[model samples]
Target: MTTRKDYTRPLDIKHGRVDMGHGAGGRAAAQLIEEVFVKAFDNPYLRQGNDGAALAIPAGHRLVMATDAHVVSPLFFPGGDVGCLSVHGTINDVAMCGARPLYLTASFILEEGFPLAELKRIVDSMAAAAREAGVPVVTGDTKVVEKGKGDGVFISTTGLGVVPQGVDVGGANARPGDVILLSGTIGDHGVAVLSKRESLEFETTIASDTAALHTLVAAMLEAAPGGVRVLRDPTRGGLATTLNEIARQSGVGMLLDEAAIPVLPQVDAACELLGLDPLYVANEGKLVAVCAPEATEVVLAAMRAHPRGAAAVRIGSVTEDPHHFVQMATRFGGRRVVDWLSGEQLPRIC
Candidate 1:
C-alpha cells in the first residue's frame, strides 16, 4: 500500500497553480492524482494501474466503448459543467448503441494557472454525476500544461458498456418506414450556454439539458427491446446534422413534421433573437431514436416515462429513397429540405 509521507501537509487547493512538473510523470503527477483524481474517483479498477483496466465481463453480451473530449468555453455553465458533461456525453454515446454503460476513464489537461477550487468543484460534480448514473470512474490520467498554451481545462473521457442479448442498434440500422422520435425539447443546452456567456436576460431562463441517458435507454429497451433500430443524442450539429448522418449511413430518406418536433418556447425565442435555427443548435440530454413504425407508441411511452425524456414525441419517419434527403413539412403546410448546416452556427456551445 502506498501512503503519503506528509499527509499532514495541506493541499494548496485554494490558490495554488499547476506547473509543467505536474505532467512530467514524476512526483508532481503522483501528488496530483493522490490529492485530486484518486480522492474524487476512488475505485478498485484504478488502483490496479496496469496501463489500462482489466475486467471480467459477462458472457453472451458484446462490449461497447466510446470516447469524447470536452472543451466547453466556460468550465462551469448554467445547468452543468465540464465535469458532469464529460461523463454524460461519453455515457450517452455508449448508450446510443442500446448498451449498458458500466465504467469510465477520464483524462484531464489542466492549464498552469487554473484555480484549484474550481478544479475541485468540477471533480466533485463529476463524481456525483457518475454515482447518480450508477457508472464508476474507475481509472483516469491528469496532465498539466503551461499557462497560455492550453485552455483553462479540457477533459477526455472513454466509456465502456455491454450490449444485452438480442439488442442491435446503430446508425446503419435505420430503415424505411421506421418512425423517428425525440427524447425531449431541443436547443436547451446551446441556448443555456449562450445566455450565460452573453449575459442575456430572459423572462424564463434556459437550462442546459446535460444529463446521462442510459437509464432512459434502458427503459426504452425494456419497452421495445428489439424494435429500436438506431439511437443518437443530437449534440454538436444538433438534430439536423445527426439525422442527416443517420440518413447517409443507413441509405434512407427522412420526412419530418415541423409541427411534431418539440421545442421549448424559450428556446425558440432565443434562437429567433440570435438568428439561429433551433434544429441546428446543440443539445446535451436529448436522444433521437429510430424504431419500427409498430413500436413508435411503445418507444415514445418509454421515453416519456423517463425524466430526461418527459417531452418525448414522434417527430418523423424514414423513407425509401436513394438520395437520403431529409425533408420537413413546414408549419404552413409546405415541404422544404432540411439540409445539413452550411457553417458552424454556435461553436463550443456544447
Candidate 2:
C-alpha cells in the first residue's frame, strides 16, 4: 500500500531528473506515481490506488490479452515516440485477435538521471493515446536502474479485451484459397525511424505510420462477420516475414503480386539507395488480412472505407505448396522466394 504522507514541497517537474529514490517504494515513489502517472492516466480503476486493476469483461465474449515492449532508439521519432508506440503496439496486438480492447497495464524501467520533463512527455503521450483509443491504463509498475545500466527509459505494456463469439482470427487460420489484403503502403515506419539515425540521410522526410488500428478492425468485422480468417500487423520484419509466418503456420504457401503491393515512391527510392528491400522493412500502423475468397471484395471494400486502410489492396493469394514458401511475381515477370529476414536489417526499430 502507498502511504500518502503530506509533503510541504512540490516536485520540480521542469528541471528535475529522476533518481534512485523514485523507485524506492516509499514517499518518493508514491509522489512520482501520484503526481505524474495518476495525473495523466486518471481513471476510476487507477484512482482506486490498487496494485492491480479490477475489470469486467463483456458477457458472452472471450478474453484476449497481449503485451509488447518499446525500446525503439531516438525515443522520439518523426510521427511517434516510444510513449505512444508502447500503447499502440500492445493495443494492436490485442486488436489483431478480433477483440475489443478495454484496459491496459504499463510497466516502466527508468534509467537513473533521466530527465523528468522527458518522462512526463512520454507519460502524457501514453495517456492521450489511451484516451483516443477508448482504453484506460488502469495499473502499472515503475522501476529505476543505475545510469548506463539501462536505456533512458523502456516501456512494456499489456492490453486486455473481449472477443465476441463466432469471430476467429489467428496466424493458423489462413487457408490455401485465402486472398491477402494489405492495409497500406509499406516501409514508411522503418524509413522514418532510420532517417533519424546519425548514419542515414534522406532528402525528403517520411513519417512513421503509427496509429491505433482497432477501429478499422471493428469496421471490417462489422462489414463481413466471419470473413476474416487471419489478421496480422507487419511490424518488425515487415510484409515478407509476416506472410511467411502465416504460410508456415497454416501449412500453405503464398504468391504475391509485386506490382499490386503498394509502396510510396519516396520510400521506394530510399530503400533502393540503402540497398534495403522494402518488403523486409518495418511498419507500425499497417496490417495484413487474409479472408475467404468469397468475402474478398466485401472485406476489401470495407478496408478501403476506413481512414487507416484507405490504401488497402489485394496483394496476393494463398496457395498449396508443401515447402510453404512465400514467392512474389516481380514486375519483371520473374518470381523469387520472399524468405524470412536473413539477419537483422535494422536494429532498435519497433
Candidate 3:
C-alpha cells in the first residue's frame, strides 16, 4: 500500500493544529503518525509498525502491568505536564508491586484545535521520560474530539514490568512492628497544580514531584530482598489516605511521627493560606514503603542513595489494633488519629 501522494509533504509541526482529518485513518493520519509520534518516540519495537508489540519476557519472572489516565487541567505545570505524568504515574503503579517497568503504550485524545507545538512539547516530554526510565513506548493510538466536547488533551498510559522471584509486596502485607518510610516531601505536586490552576502567586514557587519510582524501588529491593512489605505512591488522596488504605487491607493500625514527615516550607505556606492539610493533599513523586524493623535502616540507606529519594526517611511504625486506624503523633506531643480525606481536596490533579 505504498503511496507517493502520502509522502508528497511533511507535517507542519511548527504552526499546524490537530484537525479532524488527522484521526480519520487516511493519508493525513499516516503522515501525522510518521512525523510526530514516531519521530519523537523512535525505537526498534515501535518501528516494527505492527498493531501490537512483541516483547521478549525474561524467564522465571512474573509480568506486572498498570494503566492510568491523565486529565489534569493546565496541561503544562511547573514540574511536569500530562505527558510525563502519564508515563510516571503508570510506571510508579507497576513499581509499587515490586516490578521493574520495561515498556509503555500511550493513547491520546486531542481536541480539534489543539496546537501541534504543544502536542510536540508533550510528546517530547513523554519520550524523554520513557527513555530516562529505560522504557519504550512500543505502540499507541490517537483520536480527535470536537472542540468544547473534550479538554485540550487527555493521555492514557499503560506500562508493563517484570516482578522478580521471592519478592511479594502489596497492601495486605503490613504487620505490627513494621517501620514505615516516606520517599520525600509531602503535597508538592498538589500544591503546585493548585497554584497554577488558581493563578496564585506565592513568594516562592512550588514544583510537582512527579517522577518514575521504579529505580528507587529497585534499590530498596536490592538492599533487602523480600524485606519490603508494602510499597505505594501516595497520589490522589495523599499520605494519610494511602496509609489508611494499607491499614485496612492489612488489618493493622499505623502510627506516624509528624515531626519526621517532610514538608517543603513553600508548600506548607501554600497549604496554610488555602486551609489545606498537607497529609490529605496529593503527591505524585513520593511513596510509602513499610518494611520489617530489622531491615528499615538498610532500605532507608538504599532509598537515600537514589537521587529521587535522597530525602527519604522513616516516618512511622505499624501497630496491633482491631480497628485498623492510622494515627499520627503531632509535633505538639499530642496524638491524633489521621482519617481519610472528607472529600476531594484538589480536583483535576494527576
Say which candidate scores most in lDDT: 3
Task: Write down the lDDT that model 2 would get.
Answer: 0.91
lDDT of 3 by residue, 180-285 (tens): 9999999999999999999999998899999999999999999998899999999998999999999999999999999999999999999999999999999988
Q: Candidate 2 clashing pairs?
A: none
Instruction: List TM-score per model, in order.
Output: 0.95, 0.96, 0.96
Write down the lDDT of every candidate, Cα atoms only: 0.89, 0.91, 0.92
What lDDT would candidate 3 get against the real structure?
0.92
TM-score of 2: 0.96
Please identify model 2 stretches exceeding 4 Å from their true place.
1-8, 199-201
For residue 334, model 3's alpha carbon misses the true position, in angstroms, by 1.7
Q: Cα deviation of 266 in candidate 3 (Å)?
A: 0.5
Q: What is the lDDT of candidate 1?
A: 0.89
Residue 272 Cα positional deviation in candidate 1, in Å, after optimal superposition: 0.8
lDDT (Cα, 0-100) at 216 in candidate 2: 91
